[model samples]
Target: MVWKLPLHESGHPENELTAESDGAVIRRTVLPGGVRVVSEQLPGQRSASIGAWVNVGSRDEQSGHFGSTHFLEHLLFKGTKRRSAMDIAEAFDAVGGEANAVTGKENTCYYARVLDTDLPMAVDVISDMITSATIDPAELETERGVILEELAMNDDDPGDVVHEQFSAAVLKGHDLGRPIGGTPDTINAVPREAVWEHYQEHYQPETLVFTAAGNIDHDVLCADISQALKVGGWDLTPGVAPRARRDTTPIVGLGQESVEMTIHRSVEQANVIIGSTGITATDDRRFQLSVLTAILGGGMSSRMFQEIRERRGLAYSTYCFGSSHVGTGTFGLYAGCTPARIDEVTELMVGELEKMADSGITPAELERTIGQLSGSLVLGLEDSGSRMNRLGRAELVTGELYSVDESLKRIREVTAQEVQVLAQELASRPRSIVRVGPFGS
Candidate 1:
């Protein structure tokens, strides 16, 4: 069934049954410092997945803290008050559990998966890292070199560069356009103190969300996290609320009708991306956009794949993609092909999108796309990690959570007309094109 966004009203209840259906149960508990403990119980599972989601990312970086969000992501795992870096690493290695973190434009997550018995240890370790990262000056210096190398590695890939350029062209003058891994210049300029200040400012209890899935008991998990955070020295005083939802005003582009950018790179294959700003995270037409995306370039049978690869053999890979954020999102298609055929591939990609907008998908295509999206959603939730991600992202990002079945229903109900309407809107928006390859040798 459909679930409403969690209540963020001041003095929200300490415990609430967010959603329950079939054999699965979902519950949420708010702690003294506004730390949220949300969990889903899946019977007959021996493993559990947990994540500590912080509601800040590169987009939230202040003047001196560019790239510090991702920087902290690495530093947290370096050491904590109680556990050394090696101790943290060995803790998971000894148990055969997996742990990692991701820094996104909007949030950062430190997550892990382990046997049900080891959930407590996992919780304690991640909580320690989140609340007690030492961020040693020496360690920060070392990671600086490491992050610089990471940025270099990313720049080495033309496919990656093209997408980055496309975002810069589309979301020009916006924080979202900046690379998540800050540029080398920015990284070198940011002082260790800047990172420390960033950590202290954003890593508050109210900005933290703890979510777990599989063979989990809500109350036990909440108590464990409370003790862990307390040991890590977070203020647990009562009367605080979780961070408010991000403002939902749509961010529009401020430029001419279209923009084209080309970066000269010595690469065998040219990479290209053509797209435009699309929708917001809370847009109602997201389901329709999904259907349209799949129909145009999602898979082997998709129009772009069939024409660009199967029929013409102009490219080795071609696909469509979209990313949504609080205010604006991106919609684009990419292809890596022989430099000689770049023009043909670009035309084909644009033509496919235009065709879809001019003439909506047939009934057969609509049915197939709906099934494709529905099956993908169901299959992705077969494990605890995926379910944990669903819960965490729903609570953190859109603030709305839907059961697997409910999500499937939404996809299935998208009408072809709706998909066409979205396609027409996206097609009409000003486009940005980014090309990366050797042009004049």
Candidate 2:
């Protein structure tokens, strides 16, 4: 009695078991065991990309288990019931493909890219890792040190530390503010049992979405997944819907006045991030914000680039960015400059943002940014890996999918007035400022 979910981007009744297309056929099926398989078929492609997206991340961790999510990510690849770590690695190497995984704020994905002929092996290896990992205590202890070393390496990078500090300051008192790797202290405290418990609870078939793109046949991929799941003894009965945690708490207090902090480091250059709260991932205003970001600091011709680097020669790198999560986001400018010019760089960066907000972008800027956004969007998806990511993220995170044409039309429809209104709102939000450099220079 499995049924397909709605296919039309707009809301529609769910009755059919599949949706068909000529260029890209998107198919979704709820396996008898509750696992949802969603994939796209591109007729002439040679390479295939597949991902196992789990709906859990660092933000979902309870107290005393800070780095458990990321810790699990490492252990999953260590070994499975039937394959040793080396065997798993060599399986992909034999197929001339690459396998890796990443832990995000709200989800974790294990993916592989391989020729279409080798997709079955890719599917089998990834599925085994997800469903049958041993999570051995000895392996956990070894990887714990590896993860700690990684964190220390991140601490040594000023740019990385400042961005992390900025997030902590802006998202103070919120789970989203914490680093994805969790602090070293928390990582050390997480026992092997806790890691196993987190995995069992969150890695259910009902909470996972399997996605593939490139020269793939959705039906074939689905069959392979069904067989692989059976190997791990996952029940193929109908399962429950994924659990949703809606966090609508606004970032309070920090938005009233600019909150500033500085970390003194004996670095050659000062890394600074001047940013404030912005829109969420699902907000309609995201399109407008995209245009504003590009115009302000997205490229070499952007205002931030021309003003800070080209004209004033203040920095070799200066750009603005916007990041959106489920309930909230941030928009900020980052610049690395000589320690002597820290004050001047901050002033100029802030001045440009104020000017843009106060007066809005010019006609030329709007048109150029729109074109740039349009090109970048289309160009970025010119591969199976990109398409696979788009499919996976849309299904697992956004819960909605957009055709390329639909996306381009939305970007083209953004108007100057829309950008201005959104820019003003962004500028009016409280700002969070972070600086990392040597003090008393």
Candidate 3:
């Protein structure tokens, strides 16, 4: 996965993807294991972000092994042989930087942000942390207590619970159905040996991607990644997983799904979420969905805010969001409204979606949607964390990288017909509804 100078863009970059760094050179490096590295270096920005991305996530876990990835995330934060967790936290904080990681449907990311001058320091710690950190017995026990509290907190909050539960329902029989934070029953059941076993199999650097953005020299970064690969190799086997089947999936209306999330501490406001699975991470149509989401619920001028709140005062919050992954994704709508107005509000929201289904958006709406999405993409890329994410995720999902221009182009070229198609497909999914709050009748 090494590239020579003047490396040409691989796939056609999206036309509207104007978010690239002018000074940046996109490159790839193949390390010892099959790890692939991709990046864009922006010399003008003062900061750099480096991250280790593993394609394995909670969705890849075996039954009874739920939340193992997230649990593993906690264990990583505990002291390693070289540094105590406190020491690690302090080291980053002392430098005016932040270090963090998260587990998702198809990937787990460990990232660090720092001054461009400290780029080597950034890579050194992340490389060592991901490749050689020891999972000591004492630290494991202490971390379990921390993770249990985290799980309890999730259980006690309906807003969170409904999303987790809804995920379970949508990805049923699939590893993705399980919560990223394991239940006490499962977590307590998993022994120390199993955690180690999972790590041994999943944490292969060959399947990993390391990325850096801002003030990075492509050659120097490639050299750093090569060194990390030499440190993390193991007896590797080729990885492959068949896509799960969803042949009989229904176009379930909101009423058909049982979604009751009640919190005892009653308040005037309640959050209602409607969502379901729609696309894969690699689907080209996702760009359209991004644009459509902005047009439908992105800001005050967006349809949901204009129609649901401004005109009727039906809710305080309203938005549409899309979550995409290597093989699957979820699209959702969320709003906080008066419990007394839930029925009216739900109907109004449904009408908006239905209107899109029947009458595709006008040309002006489509253009505005693309503009907002393109601007948002550019703004997000200014951060090292976000840049590293974009690079790593592109490698993991498509086995290729996209330029900022490519992304913008995809968004720009999305026709009203495509948005209509996406809308129709989204509306057709088994629409699960979750409502949490008071309704005194």
Output the number of the TM-score-best candidate.
1
lDDT of 3: 0.69
CA lDDT of every candidate:
0.88, 0.83, 0.69
Q: Is candidate 1 or candidate 3 better by TM-score?
A: 1
User: TM-scores across all candidates?
Assistant: 0.97, 0.94, 0.85
Tell me the tens digit of each residue's lDDT in model 3 across 173-257. 5665677777888887877777877777787655566777777876787677666545544332223221222222332332234
Clashing pairs in 1: none
Candidate closer to the true structure by lDDT (higher is better), 1 or 2 = 1
Worst 10-residue lDDT window for candidate 1 reads: 6-15
**How large is the C-alpha RMSD of every model relative to the true structure?**
1.4, 3.4, 5.6
lDDT for each residue of candidate 1 in 1-441, tens digit (9 for 90 to 100): 766556453246534656785478998777888888789999899999999999998888878889899999999999987888999999999999999999999999999999999999999999999999999999999999999999999999998899888887888888998888899999999998999999999999988999899999888898899999999999887877788878888875533368988899998999999999878888888888888889999999999999999999899899998888889898998999998889889999999999989998999999998889988887888888999988888888787788777788889899988988888988898888989999775
| Winning model by lDDT | 1
Please estimate how well model 2 matches the true structure, expressed as its whole-model Cα lDDT: 0.83
Using lDDT as the measure, what is the rank order of every candidate, best first?
1, 2, 3
Which parts of model 1 are misplaced by more than 4 Å?
A: 7-11, 254-256
